[model samples]
Target: MKFSPLETPLRTIMTPGPVEVDPRVLRAMCTPILGQFDPAFTTIMNEVMEMLRQLFRTSNRWAYPVDGTSRAGIEALLCSIIEQGDKVLIPIYGRFGYLLTEICERYGAQVYTIECEWGNVFAPEEVIDEMKRVQPKIVAIVHGETSTGCMQPLEEIGRACREMDILLVVDAVATIGGTEVNADEWHFDGVIGGTQKCISVPSGMALITYNDRIEKVVLSRKKVERGIQTDSDRSILAAGKTIISNYFDLSQLQDYWGPRRLNHHTEATSMVYALREGLRIILEEGLTERFDRHRLHERALIAGIEAMGLSLFGEKKWKLPTVTCVNIPDGVDGESVRHMLLHEFGIEIASSFGPLHGKIWRIGTMGYSCRKENILKVLTSLEAVLVYHGVHVNKGEGVQEALKVYIEQSKAIGAGR
Candidate 1:
């Protein structure tokens, strides 16, 4: 059989994740590969670690990327810290929150959970109170729960965890580049971030940063593999408590990413290039300005959705700026609308999982996808699809309202200037 060159349809991705890759990042992926141990390649590795430290807003000595998607970092952090039957408290507010629980359970952790409604976030005090009651060794929570378009506040929780002497690990996958993720300031022991959503990179790397607190725990369980162990490594104590999975182990990974340069596995050459370029783009744009841009686009999107006579699905105060959840109109076929939007308009949006499956539609405005043109395109296309599906939307009002937001912002900026 013969095959032709690969071709894919162009799409305006507006989904919770895997949103859109920046052209620069895509171009970087095409750069020639270098051997893993080459001095030049190692320099790029060091650059990625430094850029990640800036992106995560941390001064931690340990910062690197896991080779898999965001979940790989989450797994590595959790499994490394958790021993047999250690108590872990995970607050369940959205689908991703439950993922923490699942990872912990699989690693033999005695996981405890507290719950709130899907579209609502728990007050900081609520989680603190539960933490006190559970008295768990670790507290794992999500910063932004894209599953329901809700963002949980972490400042107060982080402070409380510090006072209580509990390890605080956070899943900041959806919030990293689009908003503020202060790793050191928040007192997080470990935090995991993703590339697909707000980093404008492809979904192949998971950025992770850890403070000394987490490093102590991970090193205590360290075990170098026999295949790569040196004569000195044989003398090092294994303590018979090595981490469960070799591929997800952080102790050995640290040495590979660290100055020791001990071999773990061959690095993903193109993916590392993509990540370096992606992080560079973010820092060049300026974190504060980028966050404000996300907020500005979010406001425009919400204005348009409300003008179309559709209600948003979460607490307004806690809605994630990167993703917007809209209550599906009564009698409207949610999948049909999405299908038409994809096929006819060359656009893509996402649907929710579990209870929110058919009740709400998730639209993302993140990183490269968060722009005036893209926002207007999604709102306009969605309005057309909803009206065609017999959902009574105010004709032309969606685009008008969105345009009003953009116009007003421009005027405010001009006046300030």
Candidate 2:
């Protein structure tokens, strides 16, 4: 195969992840490279960790970014924490929840997964009940299930975990900066996120944090790794095994970001620059205000879809602010509509996972792309695509309805101020 010089499409990204990158972040990533252990680079690393603590709403000292996508953080947390034969309880609500189950099982954890229907989320009580019954060492869950556009409520479940003395791990890759993710307040032992979603950076880094409880568990396993490397006492190594992954070993990675400044691997310097700029942008905007912004746009997008005579897939109360799922109209091909939206209007939206594929459309209002004009553009373009497929839709109603919601919300904000 022959390929030409790199030139990507200009389509507006409206997918669940790797949303539009802010130009400011792009420029920050272009800064001159510094050696990984250089004082200036170490300072930036420290700053990034501190900012991550703010974003995660945690005072935990272990907050830092993994060197890969959001999944890297997930695997790092799991592979490091789940020792052989450890019992882990996973509540499977969507594709990502099943992912946790898969990862935990791979790490030799006996996985017990309680299922909830797709397009819906579990009540905290239900999860707590399962946890009580199963009595697992760790309760791993997805904070936001992107495939189904549902955000799981974790506060009550968190308290339940604290009461039972069980570890609470959350995959907040889809919800972190776009919604509320107070890791400490929610009592999450381990929390993971991606910079590409609401944070609006390029998709290469995973923001991760863990509390002391989790640190203890991970460090115990790392001690075994140390024994193997240093050929110390083999007896202490019997109680623990080396962490399954060399690249994702949390102890070494943490040391690399920690005061020791251990050289675990070559840090992704450019992505670090991007993540720091993105975190700075989030801090400057204020987390609460950013959440309101996401909420406002999500409302407008729903209004537009409704005005076009389409219904949403998931329950509104459980719906994610960053992503929304629209049911495909009867007799209209979902992929055809997505194809038209992309090729004809230079717009991109996503399709759902497994059973929902071809039956629903997943549109995202996340990161830098979560703006008023983009919402209007997507709705208007979507309406055109629906009509092209012989689905009769009110042409102008979409944007008009969206504008009405925007106007009402703007007035409400002004009144409050």
Candidate 3:
């Protein structure tokens, strides 16, 4: 028996998330470690928070990274704000929506859901109607549904929630840097994001932020626990019979990131480095330009795919630019095509989930992977794979159509400049 030092394969990641990380960020993660509370390390933490605020386009003082995956951030936000028997409404647009509902239910909150078809987003009017009927204390929705590659409309919904005096919690795990999301302007009460999606970093941390209104709710709660206080002097404690999971306590997390600097757990130091550098890249490129690049690449990919004779899965208006869902042609094994792309071409794409599984393939134009070259390569490889599966299509037409889209977009961007 023998073992070798671990090595990871290099593949062009076109999957929905955890996209190909930049080499610079990978190098940043390899730097020497430091004590979590060391001055240098704390300085790095401060920089990370500032970068995240810039990326999130929010002025909220509570912005910081949670010590686990994106779902951890979602749980922390929900478990903290949702008291026992509080009414929580989740609009189920995809699998992640159901996940939000489940997390709220675990906190003993009464979970109610308004469902939309898999490939569609809810209209603001529809959500307003639901809010009137449900009158929920909190309304949770996904800004970009990774499962179905659909972007839910948030601005109008946020305005409606504000008028109704209901808190809005958004899961922007897939949209944050890849699209336009203005937390403060949208009147979002709390928003959660992740590093792996648009930030182009390895996964381990989740960024969460809350406005002052939500802070007031946390302060008003009578529950108190023994922990360091946060900036608002709110105790990091939960009352009631059952203790919500201790590891995910937001109050304590807020304290640790705030002035107190209390120890919660050892932070993921390497991931922090990666996240900071990833965010630096975003700021360097300018968030709006990054977003426009994503849109341009997305349009090119869709134009190429459609030119290849495949129809997209979602409504055109609601399709997510970062992750596009395309219907698999009849008689084609979606999994086999994906396997062929990986093994034969070193490209990766994803299969849909649940009911959409085996019916569609998810192709992502995200982070460092979203580029003209990558778009052409994916379309060319996909054409080969599809033809091999007996789905006859023009071999070079997709790339040509994609090139045409790039030319038009280049002209448009030039004119704007």
Candidate 4:
């Protein structure tokens, strides 16, 4: 087959990330390109920062994008704040916990980790106990661990960090738009999130923030070379210990986005437009409503899956609203079912990593793809595929169970309770 113009099947993206992009975001990106420093473009950039502040529930002036993926934002925060031999405490609950430890070690931070089972989250007392013991300079954690479909509760942990004066950093990629991340209320020194997850934008950009506590550390560790320092140049460069990775340096990135507009790598114009529009759509929906939507769809999806006689894989209370992990019933080929869903139904679902692989299916009700129809479609297709594979399932039960949840919810709303 000759490779002509690129064309692919339209898939219902119900996987962990890179969900179906909002058509409005796509339309926003289609506008003509502008120079990175153009006044109008810079205005949009400013608006994005302010909007991200609202999304993060932060008043921190440093809130902005990392110009890369979610991990990039994590690295930016870690690299800028963590010095050689600075002790960093990380609690391992899932894959992203491992990622936090890996990144901190790479930056020469003395990494101390407390781990829990993959599907389980640490209690506030547990994390606080570790903090009291280690008294590390920073505590890094993942708010939502998509790999295990778990969300770690951070309210108490954040309060502990504030009282102890330990900087609290969170990777909120999986929870930012679809769930609550009270940066200010929770005393988050830094927060990182990807555009692709609940924000409904294409993968490529990251939204992140740093508070004054972290800003103090970053400025103290600053390393800069002044060529023509202006009154507007608030850049903290290579004056002290320089950040290892220049590309991921928060100082330079901050300077560029700051009053000075110091030259850095050219921003990805289209992604900025997409992110702006994505944030706009999220704000329009209202954060509480969007979070409730994710929760409602997740509940409905789980109801449908359970009605089909499949069990969930994790602790019930900690399940992430954006991702659901369904156990593969005995004698069922999890991969085969996923393949059928992809090839036959044109629906994408994810399998787990490491020990959980093949034991569970990770389904996402996130971003633009999280809808009543999408949930019904996948649950129905899954039942069909399961029954066809010789697993016993009642016909039409998945859709029926899911619709029941919607009806109950609507009636409750109607009753104004």
Give the better candidate number (1 or 3) by TM-score.
Answer: 1
Q: What C-alpha lDDT does candidate 2 achieve relative to the native structure?
A: 0.91
**Which digits, one per residue and each the tens of the lDDT, describe model 3 over residues 1-417?**
899999988798999987999999999989999999999999999998888888889999989999889999999888878877889989998999999999998888989899989999998899889899999999999999989999998999999999999999999999999999899999899999978888899888899999888887665552444433663334223334233777887777877888799898889899989998999999999999999999999999998998998899989899888999999989888999999999999999999889899999999889998988899999999999998899978668889999999999879889999
Better of 1 and 2 by TM-score: 2
Query: What TM-score goes with each of the models?
Result: 0.96, 0.96, 0.95, 0.95
Which residue pairs clash within candidate 4?
223-237, 223-238, 223-239, 224-237, 224-238, 224-239
Q: Which model is ahead, 1 or 3, in terms of lDDT?
A: 1
TM-score, candidate 4, is 0.95
lDDT of each: 0.92, 0.91, 0.89, 0.90
lDDT of 4 by residue, 151-199 (tens): 9999999999999999999999999999889999988999998899899
The TM-score-based order of candidates, best leading, equals 2, 1, 4, 3
Flag the better candidate by TM-score, 2 or 4: 2
TM-score of 3: 0.95
Question: Model 1: residues >4 Å from true position, as ranges?
Answer: 223-240
Worst 10 residues of 3 by lDDT: 233-242
Q: Count the backbone clashes (under 3 Å) in each candidate.
A: 0, 0, 0, 6
Residue range 203-283, candidate 2, lDDT tens digits: 888899999999998887776777566545465455445567999899899899999988899988989999999999999
Q: Pick the candidate with the highest TM-score.
A: 2
| Positional deviation of residue 249's Cα in model 2 after best superposition, in angstroms | 1.0
- Which parts of model 4 are misplaced by more than 4 Å? 223-240
Error (Å) of candidate 2 at residue 380 is 0.6
RMSD of 3: 3.3
Of candidates 3 and 2, the better by lDDT: 2
